[model samples]
Target: MSPSRIMSRAIVLGFLFFLSAPLLSQSLTDEAATIDQLETRLKAADKEAVTAAMTVWVDRVRSKEAELVALVEKRSSVEGDEKSRLEEQIDALRTERDALADKAMVIVKAAKAQGVDGADANEAFLSGLSTHLDLKDPNALLTFALNWIKSPQGGIKWGLNILAFFAIIIGFKILSRIAGKVVAKTMKASRMQVSDLLRDFFINTVRKTVYFIGIMMALGQIGIDIGPLLAGIGVMGFVVGFALQGTLSNFASGIMILLYRPYDIGDVVSAAGATGKVTAMSLVSTTLTTPDNQIVVIPNSSIWGGVITNITGNDTRRVDLVFGIGYDDDIGLALRVLEDIVTKHPKVLESPAPVVQLHELADSSVNFVVRPWSKTSDYWTVYWDITKEVKERFDKEGLSIPYPQQDIHLHGLPTDAA
Candidate 1:
């Protein structure tokens, strides 16, 4: 309260304030220099350089934060204009620290993009922010969460990546369908005699292949390294192929069957000891519907390895029937009757003449072979009709159909048995 004391205090206070001004200015200049160095390293765009710079920048920011906290604590002990002056200095230092934080965040994002680990930098930044703003306050925590959600390296970037991944997958799925339709149309327009089963296989294969490529692209878009994924897939395929040797054999056999076309859908064929109509075919097995309506699934390997008799491969087939006549009946009349019955059948083919001739002569009867040509589809009908007609006509014409008969001698074995 004395003039001398007040004057002395003012002189000392002015000198202290003057000293603090240069120190604050120096601190700002040093922070600027650190930021500039970080920017230069970022421009280099090297992972190691940027990462090193980020570490240095984080340490500097942490040191500056400690200084800011000290100033805040020191302000609590002051009063009047000194308190106000300290408040201004704290505000300026906080602004400078915030600028450094912004710069650090930029470096962190860039480092992450360059495949550098930014965990330390991120933790340092968040720790500084949490210390500056009381995270115990709900509003502060909400603000922090909002800021993170809005940041480029946070929720927004990850959300965009996820959306892009799904978009790529969906787009590729549509493209695959389009590709399948195009393939089917092209195959239909072409003159190649491709079977239905083969055509379907090709179309499905094309669609699946296109879809798989889309999945790979989607994974890459989501920042996944597809190179290793593809390599792993190849290795797995090799392992699976080695394990499924029998399946591979069936697959190969199926391919051969497709190429050679030993039998096709709806073809009545005798293959692998089973006689049936082919209903479906796959790379592993062939499905058949037997004449009695039994469903049979035969492995392609078995079907291909054994004999394949395509009973209805050609457009026309020959129906052979044998009839035996008694030795007393007129052979010429029987042959004429057989020929008439076969020729009169509507389903029989006219170009190849029917044959009704004496084929063999036995002790009791003569055997006549009745051969007729007909459309493959109508072979059974023609055979059945002609055979029924032949029996009736033979009976009406007084023809004797003979069966095997044995004559017994009474004197030979009777005396020994008695």
Candidate 2:
């Protein structure tokens, strides 16, 4: 994007925020009143309510500076009459914003006086950000302490927040476990055949989803504004997703592969430009062990986007072997020898039967195609053993195996050159 366009976008964002600022500001008085009530409730050992109240008040205070900055940016974008008008609005809001920040510190101090030890430093939104006067006078400290001790509004909500946090976690944990087990058990008993990888993915995703919802609910129960937090989380997720686009692609491909069952562990597959037996798989990549015992890892996207040949997917496989014999050799005898060899092979299946045919006639030799069906596991064994048998049997039976050769026919041309 060009500089002007980027600047324009920033201006528009600022404008939108300023347009909404008034409505947000309108709730200030109500929020302050709510904080006071929650504080009063806290001193009576109503720990959870106090934490909830403080979180609300503090978050609003933290957000004030952000709103002020946005308003100033917007005010700078206008010109002449509009700029002058915005300047007034920005100034008024700045004053209000400062008062709110100071108010936040006061709330923190009151909470601290009540034995709420957690708000020291920046722990309490306003108190940490804004400066408070030191209570150097003994009499002043004693007076504040007495008022706080006697006041119904005081600290001690930390313990309640902890209890609420754990309750949410433990409850969600149990529910997530039960839901996962039920899904697993159902899948196991059902006719639908889902791979272990896919099954586990579903289970884990469900459990995590449950835990996330549980946490959000718990936060809401403690008086925190879950809405704004959720919005922030959504933005963070977008940024993370953009940064991890490659990983996301692999993840999507992995899900597709699992659902389609293009290949499975222990299956010999030719995928991702590599041929090997599938040894392991995850949402990101698949691992293979080659014949030479070399390990290869291929991204799931690479595998899913290309052709996948599952060599051992079926219960049986066909082994094709071609042999050549001299043109003068008896075709029937050569075929009979091949058929005999295939039938006696232990690995070859009889149901599909063995096939031997004079497939093609070449200039110097006749080609015979020997096709045999065998158990997938024993396909290579049958192919190698039968091919070796044919070579030896042809030698023993006196059947000639032809090779390419040429006859010299140079005569008169050679004499003329000489």
What TM-score against the true fold does each predicted structure earn? 0.62, 0.66
Instruction: Mark the regions of model 1 whose C-alpha exceeds 4 Å error after superposition.
Output: 1-156, 327-329, 405-418
- In model 2, pairs of residues that clash are 39-153, 40-153
lDDT of model number 2: 0.75
Q: Which ten residues in a row have the lowest lDDT in candidate 1?
A: 22-31
Best by lDDT: 1
Off by over 4 Å in 2: 1-153, 156-162, 414-418
Q: In angstroms, give how far residue 227 of model 2 lies from its true place.
A: 2.5
Candidate 1 lDDT over 109-134, as tens digits, reads 66667777765557556455733543
Give residue 352's lDDT in candidate 2 (0 to 100): 89
- Which lDDT value does model 1 have at 11? 100
